[model samples]
Target: MTTTLTTPTTTGPSRARRVAALARGETRLLLRNRTAVVNSVLLPLLLVAAVPAMDLGGDVPLGPQLLSTAVGVTLVFLTYYNLVSTYVARREDLVLQRMRTGELTAPEVLLGTAVPSLLISLGQVVVVAVGVAVLGEWSAPVEYLLPLVAVLLGTAVMTVLAAASTLFTRTPESAQITTLPLMVATTSLSGLLYPISSFPDWLSTVARLLPVTPVIELLQLGLAGRTWDGEVVDAGGAWAAAPLPLAVLAGWLVIGGVAARGFRWAPRR
Candidate 1:
């Protein structure tokens, strides 16, 4: 008599289980990395607090400027830097590749990885907003709620952009170099250091076209109770100083989506 051996089949983890596992692992990794933790959390808080004291020497209220500055820093540290570093580390370690082979879809893996960072950012925003409101006497109008939406949308766009950028990054060390262009360009053009309105006409025109411009405008408008009067005109002239936050953000979303589709989880063969 001949006996045949049966191979056992393994089932993948549930969606919830996979997400939880991914989040836990990512959190642990983030905690162990001292520089990542400091850059992601501590530096942003310091910048937010420090900006209010800076001598802009302008008539603008410190509250509004601080709010805008805080938002910019949050986006940079939480979304852009965090995503780039995390993606690079995961890619180099084959975590992304392993996740892709599991039950988790590409979108699921990306979203799952971003969940922890998103939570951290949301918490930071709450703390900063409360502190500013109490210390800076900030009183935003109800209609200004739109800027919060812009922040959320912008963060999502940046997260996807980070993932797309990682396709070109081979290791975590290279992420620092690859991220410089985006960090510098966005920080300068996004009104982090100074208001774009103060820039030269030509420079302001270029700033408006950048990805972070609309978000900053939205935040400033919300915080300052300013109206969009069509003063700033883009090359297309379609935005026209309007609350084009949704439109501009949607454009970035589309670009990021296309890039994500083209992104590779593993090194090219």
Candidate 2:
């Protein structure tokens, strides 16, 4: 008679516990990088501080514009760009590979690594909102849910985009170059700083498809109850107009998700 021996399965920490532990470690590393501290945290806030100085002119409300721009800045610099550097650094250091060899799920690993950046992004949102309220005399958002949704979805999109971006970035330093195209496009063409309507018709149509454009568009509608072309919208109309931009964001999320699935945990040979 032949007998087979089986090994029992063992469970480790809960997903939340595991992720939190990783986040704590990453937060410490992030704080140690003074350049990242300034670039990822300070620079975006500084840019948001400058938003109010823009001569946007006419009926364009400074409050919505400022808040929307702040959201975009947070998404780009604080979340997306910072995460690209983090992922690349960790991958090169073999941290991601070592983590994957353990009990942590891939999602948990990525999410944990992303926790600090996400927190900073959310904190900046609060800071910007309060600044607009107290200083800019900004009224509360017309449909608060829409702007909230915009930020949440935008964060997810940026997170995945950052992961996908690592495919081309061989090192942490090269991340700056690899990330520049999307950064520039989102800032310049996504209507974060300037209105997309100001672009020529074809260019505006193209710009509308960018990952961050829908985010800014959603914020504009939610905060100001105004459509992208400056049309005043009621609460109902604001939500009604949401599906198109939401679909656009969803598309980018799907695309980024696919690309990120191919992300390499180990450094290139």
Give per-model CA RMSD: 7.8, 5.7
Tell me the TM-score of each prediction against the true structure. 0.82, 0.91
lDDT of each: 0.68, 0.84
Error of 1 at 73 (Å): 1.3
lDDT of 2 by residue, 200-241 (tens): 999989999999999998998998998888888988999999
Q: lDDT per residue, candidate 1, 62-93, as tens digits?
A: 77666666777767767777787777777667
Cα-lDDT of candidate 2: 0.84
Please give the range of 10 consecutive residues that has the lowest summed lDDT in model 1: 1-10
Candidate 1 lDDT score relative to the true structure: 0.68
Q: In model 1, where do residues sit more than 4 Å from their true spots?
A: 1-17, 57-60, 227-242
